[model samples]
Target: MKTILILYYSRHGSVSQMAQYIARGVESVPASEACLRSVPEISEVCEAVADTVPDSGAPYVTLDDLKTCDALALGSPGRFGNMAAPLKYFLEKTSSLWLSGTLMGKPAGVFTSTSSLHGGQESTLLSMMLPLLHHGMIISGLPYTEADLISTQSGGTPYGPSHVSGSDSARPLTDEEKRLCTALGKRLATLAHKL
Candidate 1:
């Protein structure tokens, strides 16, 4: 079976929800499976450290996961139009994999969630793609062939899947957003088989 690692860092739970939807999409494909993993919160204190295991949600990701996965789906909550610090910190540790080209030629995709409708979701998704591109992974985005990509008014993008969680971050994903997320995951898994 092909393993598509769904790695994400979600603070307000929106992105995490998106990850689950994406995993559903991945698993819908024959011979494809999703591996959901998340990164721990980063602390500003020099000595502060997160626990080895997270209390809830997906387990913390490891470098070995990156090296072993057949494909990748990266997700994050937008922070000032960029990926959150915790996810960035984890990617920085991937230099060893980058040097060895462990992720080269792998099919990958990105996703994000934002509080506002225009809350930099695309930028955040694009930013997450940078490291994967450097690792030589082929990037995939939601194609217009997906009906939701054309009809989605809440959150969905050609760059990838996205969600607009609202000001209080309490809004659940709209039906369109959910479909788009699943579409991206399925697309990635399908591409992995072709590649």
Candidate 2:
């Protein structure tokens, strides 16, 4: 089976929920599987470090995971209109993969969760796409044809699926948001198989 790596950093539970929906979408495609991985939180202390495994949720991502994946769905919580630092920190370590063009020509997509309606969801998704683009991956986004794009009152973007958690960051993803996430996963997986 082809593995579609759903790698993300979720400070709150919302982004994690989105990843699960994306995984469901990936698994819908025949001969495709989803591998969910996450990045650990970064501490301000210079010498502090996170444990090898998280207390809960997906395990931390590894370079090997990125190297072997057939496709990628990158997700992160929006932090001031950009991706969270933990995710960026992880991406910064992939220079070896970049030099070898390990991810070149691979299918990839992005997702994000924001605390407010104007919380830079699109911009955050774009931020995640930057590194993937540099890696030469084929970026994909939801087309307007997805119907939910026009109907959703919550989070749904052509750039990818997004979630608008409340100020407290407790809002669950709306149905439309979930569908869009699934759509992105399926689209990426299908593209991987075709490519």
Candidate 3:
């Protein structure tokens, strides 16, 4: 069976919910499975470290997971139009994979959650794609053909799936957002299977 890693960092739970929806879409393919993982928060202190396991939610991700997955679905909450620091910090440690090209030619996609409709959800998704591009992975995005992209008032972008969490980050993923997340996962899984 092929496995697609649904890796994400969500502070307000919206992004994490998106990840789960994407996983469901991935599993819809008969031969593909989803592996969910997350990164721990970072500290400003240079020498500080997070516990091996998080106090709640998904466990911390490891490089091994990246190397072994057949495909990738990367997600993060938006922080000033970019990916969150914890996820960025984790990606910074993937130089070994970059050098070895472990992710080259793999199918990958990105997602994000934002505090407002225009609060950098698309930018955050694009920013997350930069590292995957460096890894030589083939990036995928939701196409307009998904239908939801044409009518949704909530978070769903051609760049990837997204959620418009309210200013306080209390909003949940809308049905449109959930469908887009699934669409992206299914698209990635199908492409991975073909490749």
Q: What Cα-based lDDT does every candidate model obtain?
A: 0.94, 0.95, 0.93
Q: Give the per-residue lDDT of model 1 (tens digit) for 90-134.
A: 999999999999999999999999999899989999999999999
Cα lDDT of candidate 3 equals 0.93
- Residue 185 lDDT, candidate 1, scale 0-100: 88
Model 3 agreement with the true structure over 1-195: per-residue lDDT tens digits: 889999999888988999999999999999999999999878897846689988988778899999999999999999999999999999999999999999999999999999899998888999999999999999999889999999999898999998999988898888899999999989989999999
User: Can you give the TM-score per candidate against the true fold?
Assistant: 0.98, 0.98, 0.98
Q: Write the per-residue lDDT of candidate 2 for residues 113-160, one digit (tens) a residue.
A: 998989999999999999999999999999999999999998999999
Better of 1 and 2 by lDDT: 2
Best model number under lDDT: 2
